[model samples]
Target: MAWFDEVAKFNTPQLRLAHITDCHLFCDIDGEYFAVNTAKHFSSALTHMAQQPLDAVIFGGDLTQDHSFESYLLFAQLIADSPLTCPVFWVPGNHDEISLMQRISGGQIKSAKRLIASGFDILLVNSKGPTPAGWVSEQHINELSEVLAASQQPAVVFCHHNPLPINGYLDKHMLENGPQLLNVLHNSGLVNHLFHGHVHNDYQFKFRSVDILSTPASSVQFTKHSIDWQQQNMGASYRLITLERLNTAEPLCVKSELIWLNE
Candidate 1:
C-alpha cells in the first residue's frame, strides 16, 4: 500500500488503460516541435482517449519540451477540459522537470506511483537520468522488489524510458541499468508487462517471459531503426492496453493496439 494510492478498486473483470506519452509540449500554446504542433496533437489525443471508457490513463512522460512551468500547466489544463474521469498516473521523462510536474498534479491528475485496478497492480517507475539516457537506481529496484513481494496480484511496470535497446535512433538513450530492472521483474515472476515511452515509435518485444512495450509519441512520429533523427508522416498515436484474468495459474492476458490520430 506504500506505493499504491488509497483509491477504490474497480470491481470489473477487465482493466483498460490509455497510454499517452511524449507530448513534448511547450509553454506557448502555439509551440511546435519539428513542425508538429505538440499542444494541438496532445489535445487531439485527449479527445480521442475521452471517447472510450477506461480504468486509468498512464501519461508516460516527456510532458514538456520547453521545460517551463507553463508547459505543465497547459498539460493539466488539457486534461481538465477533457471528459476523462479516471485517474491519470504520470512519470517523468528525461526532458521533464519533476518539481514543475509535482506542482501541477492533483485531482484527476496524480503523481501516485502505484495503482490497483481490476485485479492488477500497476507500478509507475521513474527512469529519468542525468543525461538523455535512463537509469534505474538500486534504491528504486529494491523498492520495486518490496512492493511486488507485498502483493500477489499480477504487476505491470510503467516507466518513461525503455529498459532495452530498441535498435532505433533512440537506442542511444535506452535505460543504462536496464538489466538490473529486468532482473527484478524476472525474479518477481508476478510482472506481466513493462510499458514505457520516449522511443517515439510503437514497439513491442519480449525479454525472456515479460512483455516489453513502448508507446508512440502524441506529437511526432519517429522512423524506427533509423540511425539519425528521421521523421515519418504517420502522425500522432497512442496505445490502448487491456489486462484480463485468464485463470488462477496463468498470468493476466494483455491485449494492446495503437490508436492513430490526424493521419
Candidate 2:
C-alpha cells in the first residue's frame, strides 16, 4: 500500500475498472437468503474478470444482505480472490455495516473516498442513511466540497443513489441533498461523470453536462423507469469502467460495458 503515492498519478496512461453493485451475496443459495445464488453470480464475475486486463474493482454499494459480520467476511474473501493487485475501494450501503466492516476489512470503510487515477480525480460519496431512502450529512457534504475543491479536472463521483429525481415521483427517496451535490459539481465544472447504484437498473443521463451513468445490479435486473420493480428477474451483471485518453484530451473520455451473467 506504500505505492499509493506512485499509483495516484494515473501513470498507467489508460485504466479500466469493474463496477459491481447490490450483489447481496449470501452464504446460502436458498433458505430465504438475501438473494439466492448471488454468490454464484459474483463467482462467475470474478472468474470472468480474471481473464480481463482491468486495473481495479469499484464496488458501488449494498455488497451484503443484512449488513452482518459474516456477510462482510464472505465479501472480503470473495474480493481477495479477484485478479486485482490494484485498489478496490467500496462505500457503505444500506445493506452493509460501516462499523463491523471496518473491524473486519482493516480500517473504517466510510461513506466515500476521493481517488486519483488515470490523471483524473475520482470522488466517492456516501448516499445511504438509516433507510433505503438515503441522505447525506452536512459534515459529509462539507468534506466532499473540499475534495472537489482540490482539483479542477473532470472526476467520476460514485454513490449508492442517483441525484436526479426519477420521473419526479417519490423523489424524496432519491438523494436528499442531490441538488446541493449537483451545485458543487456544477460549480467545479470538473465532474465529467457520476456513477451510482441502488436503482437496480442500468441507466444513462446527463446532469448539467455531467454524465449520470447507473449500472445494472450485479445480481438482478429491473424494469426500466419503473417505480415499483418487484417482478424483475435478479440477473447478474457488472460494468467495465474504461477511462480513455481520447485523441490526447485533457479530461479522460469514459466508457463502460454492462457485463451480464445468466443472460
Quick one: best TM-score, which candidate?
1
Candidate 1's residue-wise lDDT over 113-146, tens digit each?
8776656778888798889999977777888888
lDDT agreement of model 2 with the native: 0.69
Predicted candidate 2 versus true structure: per-residue lDDT over 141-215, tens digit per residue: 777676666655567788888778765333556787777877777778777788888777777877686788887
lDDT (C-alpha, whole model) for all candidates: 0.86, 0.69
Candidate 1 wrongly placed segments (more than 4 Å): 1-8, 246-250
Lowest summed lDDT window (length 10), candidate 2? 1-10
TM-score of each candidate?
A: 0.94, 0.84
Error of 1 at 220 (Å): 0.2
Off by over 4 Å in 2: 1-10, 27-35, 82-85, 106-112, 168-172, 245-249
Instruction: Report the lDDT of model 2 for residue 10.
Output: 53
